[model samples]
Target chain A: MKAFETYHPIVLFAYFASVIGLSMFYMHPVYLLITCIGAITLNLLLNRKSFISGLKFFLPMFFIAAIINPLISHDGEIILFYIDYNPITLEAIVYGFAMSIMICSVIFWFGCYNVVMTSDKFLYLFGKVSPALALVISLTLRLVPRFKHQITVISHAQKTIGMDISAGNPWQRVKSGIRIISILITWALENAIETADSMKARGYGLKNRSTFSLFVFEKRDGFLLGIILTLLFINILGSYFGVTTYYFYPTFTELTVTPISIGLYISYASLLVIPIVIEIREAIKWRSLKYNM
Target chain B: MQAQSTARADIYSRKRLIFSSIIIFVVIPIIMLIGVTIFNDRKYNLISMIIVLLACVPFFVSFERRKPQAREILTIAVMSAISVAGRAAFIWIPAFKPVTAITAITGFAFGAEAGFLTGATSAIASNIFFGQGPWTPFQMFTWGILGFIAGLLGQKGWMKSKIALIIYGVFAGIMYSFCMDIWTVISYDGLFSWKRYLIAMSTAIPFTIVYVISNVVFLLVLAKPIGEKLERIKVKYGMLNN
Candidate 1:
């Protein structure tokens, strides 16, 4: 429910970079599982309360993913069910489950990031150089909730007028939906005009714009940045040397997993865990401060 | 009276040109990339050069007009990018998968031009992020039409009702699937006969279900919110001509 929470943007950025880097280089099922687990565990640790609250949003999606993914992906070995010529394999099921886990973990991480990395963090990082771009990102984030709220109001108003879209057949429903959207279009255009005028009146882009930053790079940020830079350097080197390679299609073969690959994977997986570590450390620090007081 | 009318008309046409030019410069190359990938099996690197060349057109035209402030233009460009990212989020939503409703909603909210941009951009960008192949443009056009239809219908007030949105979503889904199926046939070419198309349909049935379900869910979650915000924006900004 809170709009923003405190966390280091660099750490979060590093974490995402590492996860993406690892996923690209080392894409084994087992390694993916570890990454997923790490993501979920961190998600739970950081956003326990929000996770509980947001379960409604996530639960239906999880079920849909679990059931639907396996049905669509007709791959893997160890057939479990045979309907007509199609085979539903256990491998496919596990793959789907893993995929769902991966997706959910990513979503949770995004949610955490959204909470922690407020527009201020973005502005802090890139505002000075690209104020216009930073402003747009901030506006977009602000717009999401505003847009959601507006839709609710419009639908309610329409319902009162007996134009209930939910009460109709499929074809009629489409017609009615178009009508509502037309209204929305007019509204959005008008809003854009007002935004343009307001921004103009305020003398935006009059000269080179300077941005204000709230976050001062501290010792912890420096330490985390150094770790991230080293890890990224290592990851780049690994990729450059052709350390991780796998072939699919004509035949599937796994290249020998070197110590470097394992080390990189661990580092990548641990990157996602860093936020949770920071949160725990913060909680401990807060508790000690309270005790001393 | 004739002279006055001519002057007003000239101004209006000039405004339209400015707007259209901006859109063309920003959106056309993105579309061309999709076109090349679908029609020809070329990699995406080729499109980057095209983008650079095409991007200069907008800068030149905008610089010529000098009516709309640089910040205003930048804001539009930035909004366009965010819209692209938002549309991409729907794909990453996992359960939603790839559905026509996103195209429809985008088209309905932004208009045909923006809808086209959203459709094409989402297709290309998602493919690039996930992994690109030849089918990218086909998917782009398919989704682009969904938005185009939504915008076209929305402009006529057809998308105002919930029933209409749902129906539009379903129709868009069907159109998308049908188009994708055609592309499959084209890709397979000689290997896929008339009978194979039928077989392919049967195979694609599950995906069709997912598409429909995603469309329905997306409309249910998004329609009302998008509608109201857009209305507010319209009123506040004086966007529509009466």
Candidate 2:
């Protein structure tokens, strides 16, 4: 699918603001779950193809987040099981689940951002800060699939020579795998050095690095930014007033879902939705532009 | 036949360099680092740091080559970073609680180099919030080795099976504890006593079980999907040799 379609910068900005806003304020499992669902739904609708493509990266992350978070955090109540007298509490489980949802949601949002923001948008946002660093970030995003491709080719070639990593004893297999990584690492570093040389040759990071952006701040962008600012204000106020507060000491206090809390949650959830809204507006604008042409 | 033979030889030579570099740089140094930290009474904190710094030598040397191109290098670095960060972020999630498992998955999906980099990078970077200490290198080496081994297992297809992944997780957990025990011995100036070792191992046992279980669950859930994605990436990028 197309990586970047025209959307108001405010929409993207607001979306990010909300995500950061929610993550900072809330600690409830329910709130995290709802936010995650909202993120997945928005991602699927706005960029269905990229969402699927991102699963390669996201699926493993989901499991990793879901499994390993609870073990380290052993401070919860309602012990589920005891191993060697160490209580595995339900509090830990709930807390872990909440954490996994938060992690996965953030990742999903980032993936969505990667598609929508594009290199051009990133250039627009951070070009002034450091062009060299921005270029590196952009180039890296474009490079993930490329690296994956190389590993496959190398593995296949190795396999033909009876070095198939998958067809070995466990120890031998581990050794073979290390062999592949060494090759890849060597290849990657070599590529980086060459790139550094090329950049130097081209005067990259010279006295002044010039940049251009295809984005122009429009009326919609302003409106979107205004909404985002309001949301940010609300989030800040909520946090300041302790609207999203919870306690895990003495005994676990279930988060009170007050009207203010609900409002905070809704506003934060709306942040993720902003991107989809921007995408829809852009799609309509493109259609109208096409008709005029 | 001659042309094919030449192409095959080129591939073979490339493989040889890759294998040698891994042995000399990644594997050997890791063993030595563990050995020095465990067996010697010397201040290994500085030496461990040097070993980590030295590890970058191969990366710097290899990156000098022209074949993989700028885009490919950036891609590898970013993905490696993402995988590392992703695994580390699991710690922030309170429910899943499987540190050992996550470590293994990082190793499995990325391979030893990526695994090592991820482990070391996570330990170093996470210290920004978690606070840094003498334990950083040891943690790096422990997790890095876990990831390295995971990658090795993935390459062998052992990571694909449930039982194998579980076994690997247990092995990784035990190995990590053993390695850390050695570090404690060096750092604390404890007698090379079985009681100290047992105490260290016992303290880590609960976490190890959690680690093993987590590793198993992670492998069961993500190994196949990540593998497929890696394959797709290979094809899309023309990484496969014709």
Candidate 3:
């Protein structure tokens, strides 16, 4: 298990929510750099393989976003060049880069989020607010695999009967595909009736019924939550006061440095780096323990 | 005793009425206000997301209030799961997912609310595999609304016609593409710009065409069989009556 993921679901959730929300809003170069680095670092620490693979998609998206803005929007000054009688401005390019980085960074943060906040945790959170919907989501999650397995079974049966999906022309293939899905749907809906009956037999909807979960709010979790909230509030305060706001249209905002701004930057960076710090500390601790053993 | 029970039920429904009204009328605008004022830069994506989430709140609240039976809930679960897992069956084809067709079928058989739930829940469930991102809520709202509209039309008995199915398929395609492009334009430009939006839409014409074709094909092919099966379940089990 990841060390950072061991925090209470609420703590983890609040941490990601604030980080992602802040990443979206704060476009100051310093803040964006901090978030981008923080997102990439946490993603690398948590799930490197997927992160690297995801970049294959993210990179092209980034360039397209960066390029498209200047092509369409000609609001900025410092025209770099002309394209089909349109002048490309430096400000738009910078703005585009900023937007792409912010977008990619938010996506990376979500990548970390998906790794840490597993479905069970998510369902637990929602279960608090609406148990029925959460139960529905849980059931759906369970049913997806079963349905997929059943599709394979149905397709194989069809194949034995010589209606194979892969062994036909495009039109024939699509027909076989639809036939397979149609059979699967009938089977699933029918089987679900029995599943529902079993659930009802177990008194599934009894009033005052309680939910079971293994998660507990520990002291460490509370401590981390407190720290996260404090930092988040400081950053929000910074944004509210216009300390973390930057502009790229018309002209660039002079990159300002001040005691308050530096303080805000530190807080933002620290907030983003919290999980990375936790992961590194846990790894070092584990290594030493293994060596001692 | 019967009179007292009736009175209690009246009060219960009244409370639900007020609750849903508050969520729809009061809370949704407040969320939009916050999104616009507080998160002002390129905040359309964020605002639309909150609105989408708020839009689904009333549905869930009412569904919970009804105290849905296991079979009803399981039925929705089954539909949503089928839609998500159905993506795998078409893995050979690119972007020709049956999610919308299946969602609309759920709505047509069940009701508007069930349709919305299946659409929204399947969006989240599918993203659980595809990896959740900023677009999840928009996709949820678009598909859910598609289902909601299908339910309304289905209730009118219009969805039975071949022409109606084709038109709805075309509409769902355009709706999905146009709605997603709103996010695309906003995220790229950090705000809404007509010029940028038009360019984005024009560029996405091919994708939109694919969406329209695929949706039309799936709905034309799958709607009848799935709708029949769902109707059978409802009739045989005597479920989802409310």
CA error at residue B242 for candidate 3, angstroms: 2.7
B-chain TM-score of model 2: 0.65
Error of 3 at B94 (Å): 3.1
Clash tally, candidates in order: 37, 26, 0
Each model's RMSD to truth, in Å?
10.3, 16.0, 2.7
Error of 2 at B200 (Å): 16
Residue by residue across A1-293, what tens digits does model 3's lDDT show?
Answer: 38999889999999999999888877789988999999998888899999998899999999988988787778778999999999899999888888899999999999999999999999999899998899999999999888878878898899999999889799999889888878888898999999999999989988787778999999999999999999999987887777877888888989888999999999998999999899999999999999999
Poorest lDDT segment (10 consecutive residues) of candidate 3 chain A: A236-245
TM-score of chain B of 3: 0.88
- The per-residue C-alpha lDDT of model 3 at residue A61 equals 90
As a whole number from 0 to 100, the lDDT of residue B27 in candidate 3 is 92
Q: Judged by DockQ cut-offs, is candidate 2 incorrect, acceptable, medium or high? A: incorrect
Worst 10 residues of 2 chain B by lDDT: B59-68
Candidate 2: tens digits of C-alpha lDDT, residues A128-186: 54433345445544444555676788789888888889997998886676566546644
Which one is best on TM-score? 3
Worst 10 residues of 2 chain A by lDDT: A1-10
lDDT of 3 by residue, B14-113 (tens): 7767887898789988887776677565566666667777777777787788788899999999999988887766667776788898899899888787
DockQ of each: 0.10, 0.05, 0.72
Query: Taking candidate 1, what TM-score does its chain B reach relative to the real chain B?
Result: 0.63
